[model samples]
Target chain A: MTSWLPTLQTATPEDGYDLAVKLARVAVKATQPDAAVRDRLRPEYAEDADALIAVSHVVATHFATVAAANNYWRNRT
Target chain B: MTSWLPTLQTATPEDGYDLAVKLARVAVKATQPDAAVRDRLRPEYAEDADALIAVSHVVATHFATVAAANNYWRNRT
Candidate 1:
């Protein structure tokens, strides 16, 4: 599938970067047990569900990857 | 301090982004407990240890945010 985060035509690199961060923030709010915060982040994905979901998956995997890498080196040197 | 990944002067948006993914991959390889792969990723962190470390932290936190956000809404709606 096409890249949802990087390929948006009208989005500047800065915009895309900011959006990535926004999506990242929303992702964290997603795992919370609270309904209100979840409600707040809903609009981001509501109109473009598929793209948002795809972005979410990429963002999640990316996070897991980097976190593990940083921790690995942290212990070694 | 300045942003690590985004602020790299020579980096294109695509390059900065690809580097982000590379960092993530390196992060995962880091947790493998395998010496060889860890050796491989060390060069990435070697010269600009401060910037690479900064990028790692941001990537980690961003990933955490998005993953949690995705999961929260996944269960609810």
Candidate 2:
């Protein structure tokens, strides 16, 4: 099957945001050396599983905001 | 050199912030398909060189804020 992925050229803010979210997840996992740490990282925002996903969204939003600001400044100049 | 880096067990908010900034820089570089694109990413904040560095700070601050919030929530639970 042909892959739908596009060739690498440059990342738009959206792409940066998506990548940031993925990287954050990896970093979080790297931080967790044991079940205790993983359990501690769990959120009270929602259910245990849902909380973890929400954390991803929170980090993603932060990244997307910065990426948008970067793009805005890039366009301005 | 001792490298001074600690083993990865858990990340503090500061660690997350620093890692976010570095990862963002890599992602930005990966996004550049050509010299022109790289040039365009150049900022006009201070001087050309300073502007680029400032961009990292901006993104880092955002990451730090989110990380702090995450920690707060994690602790609360």
Query: What lDDT would each prediction earn against the true structure?
Result: 0.42, 0.44
Over the stretch B1-77, how does candidate 1's per-residue lDDT look in tens digits?
67544432221223334344455555566578797876776555433323333343455454444333333122321
Model 1 clashing residue pairs (backbone): A27-B65, A27-B66, A27-B68, A27-B69, A28-B65, A28-B69, A30-B69, A30-B72, A31-B68, A69-B27
Give the candidate number with the greatest TM-score: 2
lDDT of 2 by residue, B3-77 (tens): 221211124656656645554444443333355544533433225555445455555555654454344236533
Model 2, which residues run further than 4 Å from truth?
A1-77, B1-10, B33-53, B61-69, B72-77
Q: What TM-score do all the candidates reach, one by one?
A: 0.25, 0.31
Q: A1-77, model 1: which lDDT tens digit per residue?
A: 44433321222334434454554543233233356644544564455666456555555555453333233234433
TM-score of chain B taken alone, every candidate: 0.33, 0.41
lDDT of 1: 0.42
* Steric clash count of candidate 2: 0
User: Deviation in angstroms for B51 in model 1?
Assistant: 27
Alpha-carbon DockQ of candidate 2: 0.03
Cα RMSD of predicted structure 2 = 19.7
Q: Report the poorest 10 consecutive residues by lDDT, candidate 2 chain A.
A: A44-53
Tell me what TM-score chain A of model 1 achieves.
0.33
Q: Please give, for residues A1-77, the per-residue lDDT of candidate 2 as tens digits.
A: 77432422223434545545555555667677676776664433222222322344445455645454444223321
